[model samples]
Each structure stands twice: as structure tokens, then as C-alpha cells.
Target: MNMSPKSFLFLFLFLFSLAFTYGQEGLPRLRISENQRFMITEDCEPFFWMADTAWELFHRCDREEAAFYLKKRAEQGFNVVQAVALAEIDGLQSPNPYGETPLIGLDPRQPNPAYFSHVDKVVEMAAAEGIYIALLPTWGDKVFTHSWGKGPEVFTEENARSFGKWIGNRYKDQSNIIWVIGGDRNPREGTSDVAIWRALAAGIVEGTGGQDKALMTFHPQPAGPGGSSNWFHNDEWLDFNMHQTGHCANQPTYQKISYDYNLQPVKPTLDGEPLYEDHPNCFNAKELGYSLPEDIRRIMYWNVFAGAFGQTYGCHDVWQMYTTDREGINGPLRPWKVALDLPMANQMKHLKNLMLSRPFLTRIPAPEMIPANQEDNTDFVIATRDSEGSYAMVYFPTGQSKAVNCKPLNSRLLKVTWYDPRTGNQIDAGIISKAPSNTFVPPSSGGKGHDWVLILDAV
Candidate 1:
């Protein structure tokens, strides 16, 4: 068969497409659900976004260390690994174990192929383990250097676009890639900084050849109530909203997720950077105590019940790849390798299992189903229910007895149980007749560490 020149070219392109897609066939491609409030697989299966923060995975660790770290997270039921390409903390100056920096002379336009090849291997490894990489092209320092972040500010609008396109084209074919912009810095409105990030977002889209292959979002600084919301909520390029509730003790992050949940144009939201398991409260170990396992559990349950699509778990030691040889930032208690086996890391999988065990894609925040309590302290309770009101969950931060308004469930009898966030075990609390208001005391009460989740289902 003598093929024409045009036909020959078309055949070559077709074969290339097949090869590209075949390489990614085993990976799960993710997208925003039709309702725009949660994530689902390409086949519309519910995907609970359980993530762990390891921002320095590529910048700090070698292939062997990276593999170990990833394996532990995979075993812990973490489906997403959030990392940065051009990392924070003098990443531009320091080289990886391979002795390569991401940029030549700290130029955003000049990404070193050798350095990015390491990142590629890491991403591929994560995908092989059924983990998606929520990749930040560059940390916030590259564009908006807020609060003494180590940065030379290498990205202008033009270079930002070129860098983003380069990264987008590089990872476009990967099924497990999620493009997250704005690493801990929000571009001030009416400034050139905003244009820089917007250009980067556009460049990434263009680099993907206009295919929305990966979901996109931003990680703003933990400064105010608004997170990425105040900057890019309405941006066409943004697919979801991410907030950094920060490492403060008892930060009312549920309020933040609740606010984003009720936005006019509904978009999925999550606490991308919650309080880490062992980090100091408010970044001051001397003044404030370290965050206990219960502190981490409280934030995780509170955010999810208050309408967050998922939660990201962080550790002060893990995020920076801390070691005794290196001076610890924010008082890292242990090395990254040791921090990997912390109880909180083991316990995080329970949240994903619990959510998936129940109905997916049909849950909504239902605070009205639980009556308000008069707790003088900041500790409080939050509630959520299936859209049909067949199932509901309430979280008590301090284990105080609270009255619930079961009238919203509309069921004759409700089967209640106590869910232990620490162990992911459930204890039956007996059945109750649905009423206008019912008060239930937890197994224990009045301690910062005693947190409980009340699970109710129609009987």
C-alpha cells in the first residue's frame, strides 16, 4: 500500500498518541464532579481526596529515600501527595542529592532537565502506587515573596508563562497530576504579581494543548479567612478552591470551609495545610505546646464534616525533610524518616475509609440537623448529612454534651454510634426516636484532647 504523505504523517501521530495514553492507562484520571462540590474519577466514581504534604520530596530526597517515603504514605491510604517542583527554603540555591538545581542561575525560563528528570521519576512512582501528585510548579517565593521567604523573585509574567508551559507539557500526559498554583503566597489584587500567576495558569493550559487533563487549584498563605478564594475563586483557570488553615491551635478552619461551601458559584474546597501532628501551636514551641494527635484529629473531622471535600495532613518535620544535621525550621522534633511512622500518619487512613464506606458524592453540610450549644470556648461541634438525609455525622471537638435537632433527618428512629478518630473504631450509642432536640453526652468530656464523632443513620 503506497500511502500519501499526509496519510503517513497522520498514522505517525496516531501511533504516538496511543503510546502516550498507554503509558498512563493504569493511573486514575481525576476531575471535578458534575455538582462541582467534590472530586470523582473519570468514570464518575467517588474519589475521597486524602492527601499528605511532602513539599520537599524532590528537592531534598534521593530516589531511594523518596521511594520509602512514598511507600509509607501509600500504605497509609493517602491517595494524594502534595509537593513542589521549585521548592521553598532556598531550593533555588541548594541542589538535590543528584547535585542539580531546578533552574540555571535561578531563571524560571531555564529549568534544568536533569533536575526535572528526578521529579518525573517521583511522579511516576507515585502513580504506580495509586497516588496522585498535586504538583506546585513553583513555590510562592518565585512570584510573590511574602514574609522573608528565600527568593530572588525570578518570575515575571513572560517567564512565568514559559515556565508553566514547560512543566505542563512535561506532565500533561500523566493521569495522576493535579496542577496546584500559588504555593503559600497570594498575589495582591491590582498588582503585577496577580498577572504573573494568571499568566502561569494560562501557560499551563496551553502547554496541555488546551486539554483539561489535570484538576487545577491554588495554595494561598495562611493569612486571612479567604485563601485562594480572595484571589482566584472566579478565575476561569481555577478548578477548585484550597485554603491553608495553618498550624495554629484550634483555628476555626471549619468556618473557612463553610464560607467557601456557600459561595455563589459552588466549587470543592479543602484545608490543604492544616495543623501538623507534632508542630508547635502557632509556630512557637517555647510559648505554646506541640500539636497532639487529638489536635490533628479534631481539625480533620471538623473540616470534613463542615463541607470540605478532603483534608491534607502535614508534619513540620516531614514537609521540610528535616534532619539532625540540618538546623530545624519551626523546631522539627525528629527527622523525616522517623516522622513517617507517627501515630497520626497511621490514623489518617481511617478518615478516607470512613467516608468511602458510606455513600459518596451525596453528602452535604447539615449543621441545622444539630442544635446549637452554648460553649463559651472556641471548641465546638459540626455536622453533615447525606443529601437524602438518610445518614448524618457530627464532630465534637472537646467532647462536651451537645443537643442535636434530629428533626431534619425526618426519620422515625436514628441509630447512633461513637466514632473514635484516633483508632477509627465505632461504638454503638443505641437507637433513639427522632425528636426536635436531643442531648447526647460523649464517652468523656472537657479535655482539649478528647474529641469524638457522632454517627447517625436512619433505622
Candidate 2:
């Protein structure tokens, strides 16, 4: 078929639009929506926070390596990259690839500009790819030394505030920077350590001059597959709640998300660190076996449909930037560079796409819409619906059939469709007469381990 001149022009413009959508450089500053349940751009465009965990991005990867990782994640539909400023593994003692430590004489107030310049480059690199950097100022060990991490406890209250202010000022003008204060550490109640983290957050506010230009949240240590809401949910500076589902398979992620979702002061929440793809179960590589891409698929859908504003995906090797030169922390099987193409990293875009395809602002978790038992087992189905009750999504992690309470959907005739989380495709399940209870059996996928998403739209 020959194209007319008008058709050719339209094709050209369409291609350009696609390029602009993906290739646009700078990001609009993100803010919580008016309802306080989700995030939006400054212009109120719905922002689904699909992030990749790269905790060691600045501390381990060089400039070129950082660029490569950022570009790939952008193509994979990730909008955020979580990284550390003062890394976890010997971050204070070890120099970066450029041979510079973050502080002078292990002093938080005396920041080395040379070392920070490298972090500046990584931030800029991420921004150029239209990605936000969830910047952790320092790993948890610096203040609250637990059993495992490298720690000398360098932070005093005065220096914590100073360092927070200094780092906050350094990237104040950057549109893509989000401050992540706690690096997987929960400060015990009535401890000076709590004061340290609060001071750092206060200094960040002071440094930013309380402009609210940068979004901030805390990354709590998994209280054994627990949430940040357990510690800092009520804290004023915490913009959103983040939960670390940890490396355990079959975590009851919905419990954590639901607990935060219904809190007195409503805030957006997400699984910041779910089971990293390919991570050994419970950090045990030998007996328990590594989690696959489907494990991530299960966590992503369960948490998001249960009322999370966003979700972060991780790979064991990529988080640590593990390579032959360094020890394989937690038994990383591949180098960080090689692990970048893991299937789940690419699959995360599908979840973002599915969420964006529906109503953005008015969506809510509607567990009452599904009749599945909310037990600790892997077969638990999760459900969500539009506030208007026009549409609903149910996630089946192990491909099991479940009875749904269609009356909660408020539709006489319900059009059901099956959405494949793995492939990002929708399969029609035909309209059915709506009753109080509707038994919907998904297509058989042998028995277990296959997952499917059930979408119901009121006709």
C-alpha cells in the first residue's frame, strides 16, 4: 500500500511522539496527590513509581557503568533508581572507584567534595534518562550498628543535621532527586539513634529551606518481613511509607500494605525491597533455592493491588554490584553488569502499564470485592477496585480459582478479562450475570506456579 502525504506526516509525528515519551530527559518534581494515597507530577500527572534497587550504584559502579545501568532501566520502564550515598559495605572505610571516601577522618560534617562529585554525576546520569534517584545519605550502620554491618558510629546529632543539610543543598536544584533517609535500619524507641535520624531529616528540611521541592521517605530494616510504618509511619518528614518484604518467598505482603493503607493519617506506601529476583530464599542459597522472575511478579501484583502506590524490583547481584573483584555478598551468582537483564527487571514495566491503563487517582484496595481467604498461604488472592466501583482487578499468584463478591463491584453485568502479568496481555473472559458471589475459575496452567490477573469491568 502506498502512503499519502498526510499519512506519511502522521506516521512521522507518531514516531516522534513515541521517542519523546521515552527519550525526554528531565523529570518533573513528584508530589503526593491531593487524596494522599498516590503520587503525581507537579502538573498532577499520575506517577507510578516503578523502581529498580541499585543500592551500590554510586559506591560500586563507575561513571560508565552507571550510565549503562541507567539507560537500560529507563528502557525497561523504571522511573526510580534507589542507591546509597554512604554505602553499606565498608562505605566509610573503602574509597569509591575514583579513590575517595565520602567523609574526612570518618567525620559526617567534613564531606569530601571529590567523592560527592561522583555521586553528583550518578544523580545527573539518572536524571538524563528521565529517572529519579532515591538517594540514601548514609547506610544504617553509621548510626545504629546492628549485628552484621560495618560500623564505627560516626554520627553525632550536630553532624547528622549538618551532613543532611549539606547533601540536601548539593542536589536541591535537581528535579529528579528524592531523599531516602534510613538505609534499612530501625532506630529503637527511646534511643539516641532515633534522634540522629530525625536530626538528619530536619537538616535536610533546613537545607532545602523547607521548599518541599524534594520528596522524602524512610527505608526501614525489615522487622522480619515487616514495614517502615512500624517505626516511622507517624513521623512528619516521611512523605510515604516503604516496606521491605525481604528475601523470603511467600511473604504476606498484603498485610503490610493494608496496615499502612488504613493508618489514621493516610499516606502512599510501597514494597521498597521485595524478594530480589534470583535471591536465595531467606538469604540461604543452598537449601531453599533462589527466587525466580515469577516470585517478583507475585510480590508486585499482591502489594500493588492491595493498595501500594508503587513497587520496587531488585536483583541480588545488581543491588550489591557484585563481581569477581569483590566478594559475593549473600551468594550473588552473577556480576551486577550481567544481572541487569534479568527477566523480572524487564517484566516490571508490565505492572506499570497495567496500572496506568486504568483510572489513576480514584483506585483503591477492595479486598471485600474478593472472597478469597487472606491467610498466610501462597494461594491468597488480592483485589482492588475503582472508588466508583466501575472496575476491579484480582491477582491470583498461583493461578488458583477464587470466588469473588461481585455485588461490591455494583454492576449488574460484569465483563471479566484475564490479564497476564508475565506477558502484559489481556484475554477476554466474557461478560457474566453479576450476583453477590461469583465463582471465576481461571484458565488451567497445569496446577501451581502460574499466575494470572482477573480484571472485572462493569458493563
lDDT of all the models against the reference?
0.87, 0.87
**Residue by residue across 81-121, what tens digits does model 1's lDDT show?**
99999999788988999999999878888999999999999
| Model 2 local distance difference test score | 0.87
Error of 2 at 363 (Å): 0.9
Q: Quote the lDDT for 95 in model 1.
A: 91
Writing each residue's lDDT as its tens digit, candidate 2 over 332-352 gives 888888888888887899899
In model 1, the runs with Cα more than 4 Å from the true position are 1-24, 373-378
For residue 314, what is the lDDT in candidate 2? Answer: 92
- Backbone clashes (count) for model 2: 0
What overall lDDT, based on C-alpha atoms, would model 1 receive against the true structure? 0.87
